[model samples]
Target: MQKALVSIAVAASLGLGATAAQAAILDDVKAKGYVQCGVTGGVAGFSAPDSSNVWTGIEVDYCRALAAAIFNDADAVRFTSLTSQERFTALSAGEVDVLSRTTTWTMSRDTQLGISFVGTMFYDGQGFMVREEDGIESALDLSGAAICIESGTTTELNAADYFATNGMEFNTVVFVDQDEVVKAYEDGRCDVYTTDSSALASERSKFADPDAHIILPEIISKEPLGPSVRSGDTQWFNIARWTYFALLEAEELGVSSANVDEQLGSDNPAIKRLLGVEGEFGAPLGLDNAWAYQIIKLVGNYAETYERNVGPDTPIGLERGLNALWSDGGIQYAPPIR
Candidate 1:
């Protein structure tokens, strides 16, 4: 009886030891020395390769921010281009650390797919783009129009739901990639193209005559596009979430890539906390104290990133309407660094 009891205690200790060995994702990423960021093949304002084959966009910035936080080097990231069909599978199987592509945070994806969307980096909506000659003022006028959209995306289902709910009819020309959809739309094979409003603007700008297209005024669905990770890693989720909020907070506090180094010595308490001066915020995530500072110094704040990539001065020319800070009547809010 004594021998049997001792064996049971030994087995329990082994089980506990095994459980402790499985650390959270943040620790795993730190140990690995770099982050695996999954992104789309190409989307002009969100994720795309330049002439030098360097990826740059809003989504790309998020990946860089994560790397900067973890390794204090924004370039310490390996970007893996993924299609919509492969994104969730890759994330679930741990092929990528985070999916920062323009993936919509939806109920089915969050609860059913075993992934957790950290937070919204870009608050978007589904909209349509039509040729100038089409005279379509709103999505309501798109009835009977042949629409071009990418398959295996939430946009497809949202398009169907919008048409069905409005009692309208239309034919869809589906493709596996945004480039194909854009080609089909530009070739006059489809009357209109439906996608995220940002993407619609991007596709419109690529046209031979940019002025020949107009994005309709109607936004049909809410698309909170953001970063995502596997569901089981709570620590990683918090790290991703706080990193995003830090960007927004930096913007609110007037920190920028151009001036981050100067602002690091400022007297503001909040700034110090965010810059790793007064707090040990990074230690819990297995990162250095100056993690957020590195991100701001290397990647810039959210506003700077937006302006450089997709803001009013760029070809994408997006205004900071809903993406502005909460103090400025936008929904983009961040928690205090304390």
Candidate 2:
């Protein structure tokens, strides 16, 4: 099943005029007329197709913000749904410009995958989900229980290490990808399902009875998820990295889509610099002076994106938690744009 996704991703890249592996990704993207983004096949609240088949989620918005920065059109981008196994290979092979899916930033992936993580978009942790009737109040109660997990992800290793460290024995019903894993869990093939706490919330929303499952409170691992790009393209990397920072900077500076126009006329130097009214911050990244401005005006700030996609008001219902700004007692912080 996942093998077919490889050909699809490669064909999409080739159709977009993939030329000269060493060629700068930005140049190639410009030539192609749109940014090619790789995303998970379907992960609600992260990157999943809506009823009309249009992709929607926080990660999708990140790509939209990037497109706004580069082309001044937030819709100037396309997506390819990828399985976890093919995401890295697809990126390394030039099959996609950026992997904006829910990929965790880990040591081995950072140094060994020939890819660079832009920044932590969402700080999450490993957790378990079970039927509310199971009466399992904690992950510690899952000893010897069969857990459904997706293969080719940090989830498996994290589940293994967590169980072993806790002196608990377990069995994993591994599947090739997330959709299959969810299906097996729903089919009653596994007694428990485990993954990032955010994902647990997202996936559970799709269940027949959303209130039938409960996510355990024991967070087992630190999962800093973010977008990533192929290594060796400094200019492209800078563009991708700064796009994330722009969202955070906008949130911190009180700039949003609704007020970006008004703030543009304000005299605050940081606001001016962020909106391209008083600084050339976009020049170094080969983007226009209004790059961040376009992002804020089109995609809104980080808080806006989070709230609209997966906040307490959305069906996924995730709190700001560690995704809140550093000034608000969270770890999210961006380097000043000077």
Candidate 3:
């Protein structure tokens, strides 16, 4: 009798452990039938709506990739536009499953905010933008200029630190929304606009005369912008992290939405593992074996998404300098899927 009781207790404990290990995010999102993705109100090339109200950009692609991996449908995502101040709070309150806005991954944000930054989707730098006629070729030239910046964002702190470090004085015109900041800049209420270089490119393209503005050559600080999830959910964090890495690995392996099925049978060992040809990688993440295949098939790889949204050919016209693949002398590299 004693032996049977001990055996029963052990089996119950093991079952409980197994149940606890299941992904809460996966279950919640599956039950709801859609993922709530937080995005900026309107930051072109990162997250913006088209004429038909379809949200499309690098960040939007990340959210869709998550939905595709879980639900097998990229459209199983609902985008929630958030401001800088409301982003963290909204994410913390369970209002959004993931925050994929142009948020900087800093130490304070990672530690103090009770959120986990999954991985960098875009390698960016802080910079200044001014009217072409202002002759401000560098950030140093904006010593006493009035700068337009978004409040409650890393841009404000970065701007302060950059100016202070260089012993320059400047005035800041703060706004809560990107649209207001852009409008103020357009109205000449601010002599310059300071933000991430990618955002500068994005905002400039929205101007009536995009040719009238020029982003300065100075890049002040590194900004690794990516997805974020509420802390305490390790399963959710892993899903977001591995999803991003899968996108990068797909790009490295030349797997796009167009050719994902073909590449699933590739000779490369890493590609084989990533596409779930002969590995148990996705099992550990609480996903199916073809999880990566779903992501790449539905959302394409990092390069494809970047080119379509913000690359040199797009309105943003950003060159893939540091954002290129590692083999191409860029910093974008992913770990082996195996």
Candidate 4:
């Protein structure tokens, strides 16, 4: 079903001729000397700028990994901060080459939108956060409270569905941007702020008193947040998807940026293939044989990116509950390089 929708979009993209199917986006990026990545305006642990104006987060690292694969330099990427309502339009209109703004993969988006999701980078779920003083122990306690939510996101629908299912009634205060939602919630415009649990954690970290707010225990919906590209370029799609897989594969093979050089000398077939030591993996993707190597050398592996950005020690303090490796009893599994 998904393939059919992608085919329709891909066919539309190829309306010119066979020559147009070569994916000029990659060449365009190379000519510009940087990958244009769209990111959220100010979600701390996902994609936000520091005081130095440098962007850092799990999503930022994904874009950096793509730059490392192509330019052999992780910093060869730039970011455009986008609001939820403007993200897809920016990507579809050639304003950005890739969208790494913590977007959820949904059926309507997959089939209706002219974009294709690469793969899951961060697994999240819809959740609510309330002031601790409210004494709201559960979602059931918010029967008549007003909720602050961001527009043009799945959060609004999820909240509606959850409330209706639980026979609870609530008022909604919507904002076009996430920052507005957060500000309104902070200013006490609403009694509850609802969104992805990870985002709630990220937003709460920026509050004057982080401990004054608490996230409820209910997870309302599955949100597999990942990067995406405009449809119709198979080569670019493969490049983005494989770059993400390279991160996961590197982690699974015990490879990190600190030790990737040593792993290049490894005799294991899997390691050799992953490091582009014995396989012609990069030729198909129009990249160098050392493409994956450069990614690890510059951006590190999935575990490194996660731990450095939003892991247990970070301000977000997200644990590897479901984002861990499959071998470690989590669902973060990747296919073999071969």
Model 4, stretches more than 4 Å misplaced? 1-19
Error of 1 at 164 (Å): 1.3
Error of 4 at 191 (Å): 0.4
Q: Write the number of the candidate with greater lDDT, choosing between 2 and 3.
A: 2
Off by over 4 Å in 1: 1-24
Pitting candidate 1 against candidate 4, the one with the higher TM-score is 4
**For model 2, the run of ten residues with the poorest summed lDDT:** 14-23
C-alpha lDDT (0 to 100) for residue 181 of candidate 1: 90
Per-residue lDDT of candidate 2, residues 265-297 (tens digit): 998999999999997888878789999999999
Query: What tens digits encode model 3's per-residue C-alpha lDDT throughout 1-338?
Result: 99988987897776544445347777798899999999998888999999999999999999999988778799999999999999999998889999999999999999998788988899999988899998878888788899999999889998899889999996899999888998899999999988999999998887889899998888888999989998767778888889999999999988899998888779989889989998898878778888889999999998989999999999999999999989899999888776
- Candidate 1 local distance difference test against the native: 0.89
Worst 10 residues of 4 by lDDT: 14-23
Write model 4 residue lDDT over 1-338, tens digit each, in one string.
Answer: 99988887897686634347556889999999999999999798889999999999999999999999999999999999999999999998889999999799988887778888999999999999999998899988888899999999999899999889999996899999887898899999999999999999998988999999999999999999999998878889999999999999999999999999999999889989989999899889999989999999999999999999999999999999889988888888888888
Residues 169-234, candidate 1: write the lDDT tens digits: 968999988788999998999999999999888777778899999988999899999999887665
RMSD of 4: 4.4
Model 4 scores what on Cα lDDT? 0.92
Evaluation by lDDT, superior candidate among 1 and 4: 4
**TM-score of each model, in listed order:** 0.92, 0.93, 0.92, 0.95
Error of 1 at 296 (Å): 0.5
Evaluated with TM-score, which candidate comes out highest? 4
* TM-score-best of 3 and 4: 4
